[model samples]
Target: MRFAIISVTKEGQKLASDMELVLRNDPTVIKVDLFHKNVKDTVSNLFNDYDCWVAIMATGIMVRIICPIIKSKLKDPAVLVVAENKKHVISLLSGHMGGGNKFSIKIAGVIGAVPVITTATDLNGKMGIDALANQYWFDVKQPQLIKAVNQLIAENGKVDLHLPSRFRFLENHPLVTRSYCIHIWEKSFIRASLPGKEFENELDLYPKRIVAGLGSKKGVAGEQVFFAIRSALQHLHLPLERLDALATVDLKKDEEGIIDAASKSDLPLEIVTLNEISDFKHVDCTPSKLVQREFGVQGVSEPVSLIRAGESSRLILKKTAYNGVTVAIAVSTN
Candidate 1:
């Protein structure tokens, strides 16, 4: 929602000024920070500090300077460039699919620059898979899935949308493509006479599911917790998508593993109060004394909320010495 713009010309600054005014007023635009001048060292130092970054300078250096920084981070913000003439606009990468595309178009309209949208599917009105994935919190790492969707649409005139389970619709996005289908598939697998099952292959495109929880000591290093948590999940054949969310106390704000894991999985943490957790019925858990005295009701708060959220945990992925740094796998009741 935040953008950083770079410019070296007075005209460019003026244009950025106009765009900033429009962007500030636009509800969609959260905050626009314009940087007209920067020392090479300063630019290098504060490069990765914003959510979304825009390089308006009409030079090859913008892309070069931004690319390495983007690649270095686990999650990269959208990047785009505006021509000095203000006539041509280019979305170099992470355009509409990742959000940079939408930002590019909006900026283009405000500045009167021609927004050059080059994504084939966006141009064709086929489902914008990346944007949809972003919206639905689906793990869209499979390029094959996106390509398959596009390929089906390209060759067959339309692609089918089939889901085994229907989460509530988030919004009616203009870019989302609707295909020929009588009805969508439901996860219940009960309806004998549903709409159609022709799109099973499409539904199988994504890895099924993932569920995870966070446990950490007050001072546990985030990197350490993440390493152990990820290692345990990998050991148990769990994809990051299976991660439901993190559960933890209110105190630890520096919980790197919880923050990083949720960001990676696009799942938010579900907090539990200490009072609620004090009522959880204890069962035979390993290292009984350690887990009981330190992890359950009396010790930490995240687990009870996680349990209350209908995350029926099937496995404690990793046995932890600390209550705050634990990662758990929830059962699939459905």
Candidate 2:
């Protein structure tokens, strides 16, 4: 996450320059611009080109001007307010859910101030590292096994790459041709990786970021389902390897044959509830009157998958046995 930190300070006080050294530890705070006592640039410029804004200032009035500026933008970056005294840090808005929240906490932690983390999920430490990894365009080698996430907190803890952190380290340089974490996966996104022994057959998960959804009627042909999935993805202009996991309604328990297929393919199954499926659907589609009333069309047809672009969905079943089915495959909706 790129940031433009504005420190409202007085002339000849050298607070802004002194503050720069304090914030430099956070790499996510890619850049910081100082606004001395006199600069008239509105805080809106922070949203003009950056992912978020960090305000390290003293007066509530200074913080007030920034609020309206952020209110005007449709795509708002995370906003954070802290005191120059390094005494307190408060996430007035967009703490975690917003793009700027995590950075705000880091800045607070570094300046020797308590991070006023208001996000309930974060305060409890139940925050999803996978989600964070995804947001930063980074990958997790062992997501489930990640004991704790090592975040680069900027305030007091120096943002040192070698610092003991739970998050795997990353450096900005040439695009990682070989597997690397934290990046937006474009359709033209190409990557290189040594074949995981598990995927020795095709090594399909070279750059995994997609999730697949399956929708099969009582008995649709597998060939039709596969072709339908393929054709649907091609129609959507998505790639095959981006698949991260397989999704379906809980109707298909662990006994569900499709579950076994995903296991064979090394894709984990993410069985969602009827409500969760509906929340992700792109449109209010009705698959069948009976099923629609019971579950959203996405649960019935599996169409809500949208992790990122350049990814797709597939149904794994016996190609020989035909089962009438429809599948929706795509990336997570971050």
Best candidate per lDDT, number?
Answer: 1
Q: Write the per-residue lDDT of candidate 2 for residues 1-334, one digit (tens) a residue.
A: 3455666555223544665776554322334665544423656444555555566665475466665666522245666667767777677654533544556556666666777766444544433333234333333444322222223121111111121121122333222111133333333322222223332211111133555556665444445555555554453334343356666666754434565556554557666666665665442232456566655443444443342222332221111112455555443322
TM-score, cand. 1: 0.50
True-structure lDDT of candidate 2: 0.45
Model 1 lDDT tens row, 55-116:
66764767567555555222466667787678866776666445666777777888888887
User: Hey, what RMSD does candidate 1 come out at?
Assistant: 14.3
Evaluate model 1: give its lDDT: 0.53
Task: Please give the distance, in angstroms, between residue 247's alpha carbon in candidate 2 and its true position after superposition.
Answer: 30
RMSD per candidate (Å) reads 14.3, 17.8
Report the error of model 1 at residue 146, Å. 3.0
TM-scores across all candidates? 0.50, 0.37
Model 2 Cα shift for residue 90 (angstroms): 1.3
Model 2 TM-score, 2 decimals: 0.37
